[model samples]
Target: MHTIFEPMKPIPFSPPRIDEKTIEAVTEVLRSGWITTGPKTRELEKKIQQYIGGGPVLCLNAWTNAVELMLRWMEVGPGDEVIIPAYTYAATANIIIHIGAKPVMIDCEPNGFLMDLNKAEAAINENTKVIMPVDFSGLPVDYAAVMEMAKRHAGIYKPRGENQSKLNRIMVISDAAHSFGALYDNTPVGREVDVAAFSFHAVKNFTTAEGGALVFNLPAPFDNEAIWKDINRKALHGQTKDALSKTQAGQWQYDIVEAGYKCNMTDLQAALGWVEMDRYAQDHLPRRKSIVARYNQAFQSCSWAILPKMQDDIVESSYHLYALRIQGFNEDDRNALITHLAEMGISTNVHFQPLPRLSFYKNMGFQESDFPRAFEQFSNEISLPIYFDLTDEQVDCITSAIKDYMQSR
Candidate 1:
């Protein structure tokens, strides 16, 4: 007979896959004298570039900081608008607010977590400087569609700074925090957009304790390497050389080119990322894929289940979140399921509550009713746990709990 699972030892929602390997790498970094933003950070950037085969990658302190710096580099400020989806984390809009730019929020498609491209196109005007599409739950947005939209709107595009003048159109910056290893058009997600910002927070599939990165792939007439250098300098207080380079003989003398933000990644964080990147493609991602598959198998036959969009011909998700929706289930039903699971030693979460529902955005005159689809998607959505360390048995247990709850109801 099988023993009953107990709530005393509850399953975590999304824990970092910290093993002996991660411990060893971090220990080595601690032992080294030079610990902050050193060789390991640079090495991790290179590894990320190689893995994605995109433009130069720059690792920074957080996704919010990296993308905010990108906006500052583009000189987006008052009277400029950056279009974004309504269904996403607060950080997506917070970064825009930090730059004094308006975040023109658009509603998601009906029964979808991603923004409606048709509505997005209609929402564009001359003040629109950037279009930051989020890859919700590791599933990449239609980046090519966004690029085409930008090109179509080039005639009405307004240029603020040198960087904006060079592009001569709305910039497409992807909020790919959950899609580090995902693919769009059979290539990595970072390649299609002008810039892709990824999060390496503790709960992500690829973790570095607390960090993020940017992959630059701007079109011609814009030198990516120079932009990378400029961003590197900007991330380090606009200093001519980083701490690692300043250590070299006769390199002590450096000048501050601009008053830049301090958001560079440290060696300790980079070391953890390095260890993750070393086995990411070969080991970590495959395991996530397996868990997603198991969840899919369990829910496919259920009439009430609306499975997440994991993969298709054009795109493949990184499987960051298994946001499963239930048909005919209201918000109360979803919360009930979560509470029931918690009582049975399982943990589940909701991906988001939609930005308009939040007090800050709502106070900004953004009514939740305006984005009906976003509210519809958020009301019934449930994000199940999917991580590298989640075992097959645990997957079954979690699925069984959900099935039991639904069937009983």
Candidate 2:
């Protein structure tokens, strides 16, 4: 155990980088009186659409809700199956379950957290309605390969007894929680896939305190305006008009189209988002990238460390996480290392436990051995602190502590 002369300062793993500007913006919203879905939210949506090129952006209370809404909009339900990675957060699979669909979990690439396209191809069946790929730790997946796979499997993988001649397009929904600012082949992440749901949680790179957005890039003949309107109604109590629209003269009365989920983003949250989005590329992304580079350099000298890959010909990550794998470390050893880091006043976290390892998923017939690569990566991975405000000295201290712990072990 490490002892300290002065009190050991707790370094939180990942905290919101809120400053005076964010505080002031939130205060402004509070003072504005219209705190619900209003002008601010619309402005934020527009700005986000512009930021990620052009697309139909819909703001929501959470990314989970956005994904569920997308599933609902796409008409994915019972007798349907959605392909997802076994290594992702439960929310990705849970949403499919929510809509009465089968979540066909696939194995990740060897030593990499992203989905293996080959395994994804093997998992596709007649019932496969969607291929939901996750951009794990801000690294964009191979969108072109996924697109090609979807095209190849379109005609053959149709409902049993249905006309095999008609191409059954498998929608590609991207769970882009950590990839708001990520890029695939110089194009933004949102525009790469058919649809993408981005998280603006406090811990994410670009935050709205507690918010998320969906970007739709549907093909021709699909009315983007109609889809946008339906999503807007569905998010706001299924009402024909939102509070802002109803407040206008001679528009007080409206009708409920469907029983929809109440998951609209508030103006207060959007106010912070608007400011954060403006400064994201200029201030936040570069700082986080710098931190990741420093961490990579520090761990490069350690033989036991297997750093996360951030480079590729087709992708550029947003640096949302620095997931480091410790060679020759079991789950217990990783836990012991985390405890050791805590004792040394450094905080760390595990990205996820393979979904099958969890009791709920296990009860649902998933097994750990079914996803060998995911389980292996999950057991050894540790996410270090990498945020905008984390200083260079703190980075040095964190690396030194890890080196010392490794030597001691």
Candidate 3:
């Protein structure tokens, strides 16, 4: 009863590829006497800034807190509204709540996962402080359009504090969790947005085990180094001196500047980042791109196969997730197909379920009907296996399995 093409091994969704070089780097950090937030963390910040073409970079413990740090720096709080796409992960909106700011959930693009700029424009009002754009599926949003929209509505934007008044415009805190190396019109994600937050979680294209970063790309009058110092202070219990600095002979005494949250990145995590960043542009990205290219090549001719975007001249993805959409497949049938694939040893996943549809948002009076397009994206979408170690033959197997599943239906 079994076919000759049956899967020989289990396929995981996404796994970090840690080679011996990465292991040795982490081991070196372990051997180093200072294991806390110290030299390695600072080095990672510098390397990230260099990689991003000179912007303020803060290495943190999670992507969520990284965004919160920017919001806190912006002084976003009660009565302020932050616009977020309903199609992204929850943390994108949760940080808004953490800062006592309201989250205005908006529908995604009519046929895509990114935020709909037209809808976002209409949603902005006097209370709108930030527009958090997510780079869903590793494809960067239209940065120029987003800025132009913000500029158009600049007259209505009200500044609550010194930083807000100094900037005098709505901040675009791009939630670029899925897009580390993604580019929009020759500009990196971090460079294109006001402040972009990135995740280095295990499942992402690049991993630091459990780490994140915040990058600044603001204009003149905003001192990048001064802001970096403020963020550094904010992340470490507002301590004037860090542990490394305290280790110095006469620098032991310090003061707590303000009540700050603790989410500083450690030397162990930064060690992983140093290795991964070195490999990303040269090895990891290309390998992931090849896997996606193979998937696209196999599925392009099929009528039901709605392909994911790999790149255009204007937008280049980090090749993070292979979000494949199947035409005419409803939610029920999509779930069925997922079960079928799992039975065959091929793992599949849904990119998102749209925030408004979740129970928490529903209890807050937000409806799934408000975000029809997000539901449409969630219904038929299936993210394929897309890690660096996936093989060409396995890619063929995945495509063949999908074709067979479609045929069965």
**Candidate 1 per-residue lDDT over residues 137-185, each given as its tens digit:** 9999999899999999999998987989999999999999999999888
TM-scores of the models, in the order given = 0.97, 0.96, 0.97
Maximum-lDDT candidate: 1
Winner by lDDT between candidate 3 and candidate 1: 1
State the lDDT at 178 in candidate 2. 94
Would you list the rank order by lDDT, best first?
1, 3, 2
Tens-digit lDDT string for candidate 2 (1-409): 3222344467788888788998999999999889999999999999989989857899999999988988887778889899999988999999998999999999999779999889999988788888999899999998878888888887656543221122257878888999999878776689867788899998899888888999888766566667788888898879988999899999999999899889999999998897898899888889998999999998997899999988688889999999999999999999999998898788999988888988989999999888999988998999999888898878888887888788887
Whole-model Cα lDDT of every candidate shown, in order:
0.91, 0.87, 0.88
What TM-score quantifies how close candidate 3 is to the native fold? 0.97
The alpha-carbon lDDT assigned to residue 102 of candidate 3 equals 96
* Candidate 2 CA-lDDT value: 0.87
CA RMSD, predictions in order: 1.6, 2.6, 1.5
1 or 2, which is superior by TM-score? 1
Off by over 4 Å in 1: 1-8
Indicate the residue-level lDDT of 128 in model 3: 94
Global local distance difference test of model 3: 0.88
